[model samples]
Target: MTVSELGLLNILPILILVVWACVLLLLDVFVFPKREQVTPLLSAVGLVVALIYTIPQFGQPKEAFNGMLVIDGFAVFLNVLVLISGLVAVALSYDYLNRMGMARGEYYVMMLFSISGIMLMTSAADLIVVFLALELLSIPLYILAAFGRPKMESEEAGIKYFLLGAFAGGFVLYGIALVYGATGQTGLTGIVEAASGGLENPVFLLVGAALILVGLGFKVAAVPFHMWTPDVYEGAPTSVTAFMAVGAKVGGFAALLRVFMIAFPSISVDITPVLWGLTAATLIVGNVLAVAQRNIKRLLAYSSISHAGFILMAFVTYGDASVRPEATAAVLFYMVAFAITSFGSWAVVIALEHAEDRGLELEDYAGLGRKRPALALAMAIFMFSFTGVPPTMGFAGKLYIFRAVIQGEYYGLAVLGVIVSVISAYYYLRVVVVMYMREGDPETHSEGWLNLTTAVTAVGTVVLFIFSAPLFDWAAQAVLRMF
Candidate 1:
């Protein structure tokens, strides 16, 4: 494409974000000049503006910059979701950061930068773009994770996440190099064409694919690659943890689905078995391990891992062109639902934490219902929804995925998912039980402004189920255009 064409197609979104980030950085450094003065308000407004700017491109498929990036329904859908989640995270972070005494404009800037990476990731069709976006998303997160600089736990979480994340990035880059060598191409379209032409040397291609999967596996926190999750979730600031859980998962899954479904579809036979094994192991290990955790954050981290397994079930059944639409829609809807519910859960934890100590333990939640009825009610909704109870979006998400798996004749995986959902309920409901059944500590009091987040989350959780049909339809339409 000519420079003018590329500028028209690719540069809009990229330029919008670049300009936005630069402005925010300038305001933070020169105008605000103090951490306390830099509010998350600017970040929120910028994201909203970005979302509005990107919304008009939803139905058009525009590829630019030598076809390295494609803006289509799928990319637009994921980008909108990421932006919404980022906005919510920033809103929740304002109070949470101030309460924890970690309020800084850099925090919001880093979040926006990570969000920019997520938006780029979903649109990336070239290996170089994918690697660049991944780093962009990850580097900001590393600093955000460690933004609680003076706190030992925060520093530890940041260091551990950075070390592991860099290692995973290496694996991903190596895999890309191998794939490039095998196929003599670095774009998804090129790789797909090369694979279809019959492999002159399948060794490098297969190994590259495996390494890529490993790298992404760590990002999504699939089993065996999930050890860093619990500690990181427990130690990092709750807002960052929430963002990591929801925003990171959405971006990771977006890139993963694009790479696997479009670029490497022919390798289903090899990839399917591996994913099946990972799914089974993740479900078993995540739920089983969660049963042993008294720390609510850690429990939720494991829960998130198990949920990843559930999402993978959709991919396992994604081969038939007829079922692909439903499968993809199920995964997308599930990600959205999980994001809302998980954020609500963490917002409560962050809000309730005492100034002297982060209050994430199950014991700390005791008598929460008695002390703060509104917060307790919100937590109850999140817990119940997470457990796949009726009338919540989580149940609807699980039901759709399970139904899709069965329709594709994956009866065993479907049954396994159902069984694990039951097992997950025990731990999820434990928090609810403690809130309602226990007595309150005489000294404990509810934190302020957390109610705003809870209220928003609760409404989202309920409305998601009520409006799930339209959301599913939108996702289905987006998936149909993916081909």
Candidate 2:
């Protein structure tokens, strides 16, 4: 297909976001006198516009850039999720950067760029596009992780994230090279077609897929590749950490679902065991290690890892044709649940965080129930959601995943997932206990945007549960084209 035949309209959302980000960056320097104030609002406008473009594309599947990118229900669903995440991050950052003495125009610009990359990743139909999109989304986050400049911990976080991210990128590139060598194709569809015909180098293809998994595993902070998460979350500005938790996980899983289910199903026999082990180990380590954390950021970081494991529970059944659609849908719905819960919890954290990172310890939350009842209640709701308690989206998401897992007959994993949820309650509930049971003076900052974000997410986390059936059904429809 020629460049003119690429049908660029299929990716209008991604194009608008990237173009708007570039324009925003330029306007920040020359047009805006107070970038800290103007940039976030404009950045949000960009995301909203991108989101507007995205909504119309739903159920309208097409290919762009010579079949390198696809616009489908799957892409549209994740694009909306990632864009909303970016908007929330912007809201979380509005007061935070100014308070931390780190206000700048480029922060939001970098975030916009990163978000566009995530949108691209969700639409990616080629391994080359996947690798490019991975780097595009990751590089900005590395800088943002250290946005609290000169703070030793923040600097360390940036360096650690960059080093590790670069190494992971190398893994993906090498994997692509090997896969291309094995099948003589870099496009996912082409590779799958080649595999269906019996590849000349099946072993290399298997190794390549494994390497790709390793790279994406790092992105999702799966066990054994999760060493950077706790420190990075603790040291980075809390707002950036919040966005990283959702955006990175969604992007990584988008690639995993696309590449594995679409391109590598032919090798499911070889890959399924590795995925099972990853799910089990991630669940065990993420929850077990979280139990010992006193720092809220680190605890949530580990919690994030464990949630990745929960999503992986459904993904582990990707090889089973009978179960794959529902499993994929479960993963998608769970990501939305996790995003809502994570943003709400982090908003509360941001509300209480003090300069020099003073209010970060678990003990700092004591007496919050007495002093800030609404905020404390919101936090409690988030904790319950994280623990998979009822009347919340997390429970609904987990129910979908568990049902899919059971359907796949991965009873052992389903049982392990249940056990880990029980284990997670020990740590997640500890926050609620500290908030309500203990007594101490607690200080909180209440910005309009922060409070609004908290309320919206807290309410959505619960309300979405009531409508989860339709939501899950939509997710099921989203993945139908990929297969």
Candidate 3:
């Protein structure tokens, strides 16, 4: 391999982040106090610079690290998404950490490190690389979840997440081992060649793939594996929760799609039922349970699980040759929609959250419309978008996903998706109703950074819908280059 391909430039954005995070860590200790606001500002700057580097790489796919890392339009799309989310996360974290008495440079550093891991996962072409990326992202998050020391709930979240993540990591590693034994390769391209040519140990391949699904399902918070989500999301600092909701899912889905679409396409027929079952269960359980949640964080947690189900419809249709492009495009677009909406909603949550996690109950949202009309209006738009209503990006994303499902002739799944969406509308709209119709003083931190983040996301959540056609076209072009 050429030195150029093996060196840092081979993964320029990740390399930039590594240095930036380290610098921030060092500076945090020497030059700043625990609650210094400069840390997040610097962190955001670094993330933006990294994004600028990533932006120019669009449409040009290449391989590095002896082809173990593949940078294509798809990877570019996901990396940019994660990086941009990192910027927003930084924006959300500054005031939140202060109010919670946990502001520190290390928090931002951990987040930056986690984002680098997410970016790495997007470009990973080898199972080993993906596993490493998974660990790289997860460890920092584990620390961040517990950053609010002395908070028993935060401690519990940290411990539970660590234990579950370790278990999931073990599964991914063992699955990689089994897949290697079955195909005599760990690289996606090599695995494809082995599987497509008719592996002698197809049973091993099947079992390995199943194990991988279990492992990734945990990260994406699919049903059964999603038991960790509600508790962790509720206990962790809301800022950390906001970041994980989007960043972790993006990374998980990136690896899942890269592995399944590239290495296991031939086996998709055997695996379709499993995928279908996962998506179906996730949607029903997520939406059903969310309705019972009084804690807003837990409600959104389950809501996230349901969104995962909605996005997975794209992969269900992946096996259809005629619809593959549209299916892939739909998944990509859905992720973008989910990231923006989820992040924005969480910003509102953080604004309302007080020390010791007060004011987090659904009822606490009452009278928000009277006290803070702008915030209430933004929350309403997010609620409507989450319901997949028109004039928002969520609708466009759901439209693409449903169209893909219908085109693939999975009418039952499409119907289930629609029905569950109707069920979801009840709870999502309930928050809005409480905000406008009910009466009580709901306090907010009123942090400028948090408000800015919420406003931008709310605007993007709506405005993007009008320009969604271009996004779809870009997604189509990107998906075409995936092969």
Candidate 4:
């Protein structure tokens, strides 16, 4: 096939996701106004369809729109990861939404929109496309966080996210403009050529790169830029929080990888110091603050921030050499591991909360094992994974990332990562102890399927670990071809 024909094939996934999202929006607004909803089911189907379409595209390397977007192993790998996370999110939302009395069609619609943006982030080769895709993913999340309109906390979460998000957007746009001014181009390939020719304006390039990093730092919740994370995660609906933890992190990392790998390869050393500092600070701050939280959701919020720091370490190892394959693979693997664990953890939290009482406090989980052994066990599994315990997907992911860092001779960062993982174990295990060791109230009883997503997510955690090698191989191959 000709190059244009190849490019057209590569673009199919984005087209399919957009069309599916529009159809779901139409069905939700017109055909299902009075009905409870089938949007979640349909959203799952869409993800499955996307995944099926993506499988055939693996190992194919093609660039489209004058090198504005690329399809290859990396894009396909991350696309599959995003779609799987979306499917899991949809499944987890069913019971949680029903219990919250917010099981509307719009929630699913927003999810589809967010997934489309994630896919875009994976392939976008231009700065403008990156910013647009970032906004597309974030705007829906802002609304979803505050979907509980009457709740003060929900409203606060939504507004805070929106305001900060808008500021980040402006920063990203300005950065893009400055980079374009410096290199006379917005395309990744063009920027790389300019940087290579030694004719680009160094001052403008530096400033633009700084601004871009600042903007993306906010999205990934790095230290100093993570002030909004705790409150937003606490106040947002549990399902949305879970989605943000998994999907947002995946998308943010994808954008980070694309920008650094394609647009600013020469400055990896210059940027590495800044990223190292941010990663260390984020890891220490998130884990330390999490130890003080009485609320489960808030604790997980901080934990998610710390996890972002771990993922950022991969960027620290990124450089002009081919070593990025291992780093990129590590990032992708960790995201999948985190997605399943975080999704399952939030599912348990949502299942625990009911209409009369939203038991988000850590104390409320006392004796859960006695009342709901199955769920308690599931929660324990998620906690184990999050703590990087053995035989879980989380452990495997950490091994891959830390190995990459060590291979890159980033011994200090790798050591700090290990230390924080140890510190984090205390808090994650604390929840498990509360569930199994403490006693449940006589009045409390486990509700049926109010939050059954925990079981589903827990199963996914186990299965992911069992198949982790193949997944890692696929991700490694994908990143190798991308560069």
Best lDDT among the predictions, by candidate number = 2
lDDT of 4 at 226: 96
Overall local distance difference test of candidate 3: 0.92
lDDT of 1 by residue, 1-483 (tens): 567667454537655765787788878877875645454887788888888878888786888787888888888888888888988898788887877788888898899889999998989899889889999999999999998889998899999999999999999999999999899999999999999998888888888988988998889999889999998887788889999998778878888888888888777778888888888888889998999999888998999998888888887865565777788889988998899999898888777776645476798888888887888898999988998997899988998898788888888898889888889999999989999998866234344456777899998999889998899898878877888
Off by over 4 Å in 1: 1-3, 7-11, 33-35, 442-449
Give the per-residue lDDT digits (tens) of candidate 4, residues 251-342. Answer: 88889888988899877778878888988899899999999998999999999998998888777888737567898899988988888888
lDDT of 4 at 236: 87
Highest TM-score: which candidate?
2
- Per-residue lDDT of candidate 3, residues 1-483 (tens digit): 567958557588889999999999889889876436788889899999999999988877887888899989999988888999999999998889888889777899999999999999999999999999999999999999998888999999999999999999999999999999999999999999998888889999989998998999999999989999999999999999999999999999999988998899888898999999999999999999999999999999999999999988778876677888788889999999999999999999998998877999999999999999999999999999999998999999999999999999999999999999999999999999999999999888788899999999999999999999999899889888887
Q: Rate the local accuracy (lDDT) of all candidates.
A: 0.85, 0.94, 0.92, 0.84
lDDT of 4: 0.84
Candidate 3 or 1, higher TM-score: 3
Where's the lowest-lDDT run of ten residues in candidate 3? Answer: 1-10
The TM-score between candidate 4 and the true structure equals 0.95
The pairs that clash in candidate 3 are none
TM-score of each: 0.97, 0.99, 0.98, 0.95
Provide the lowest-lDDT 10-residue window in model 1: 441-450
Point out where model 2 deviates above 4 Å.
1-4
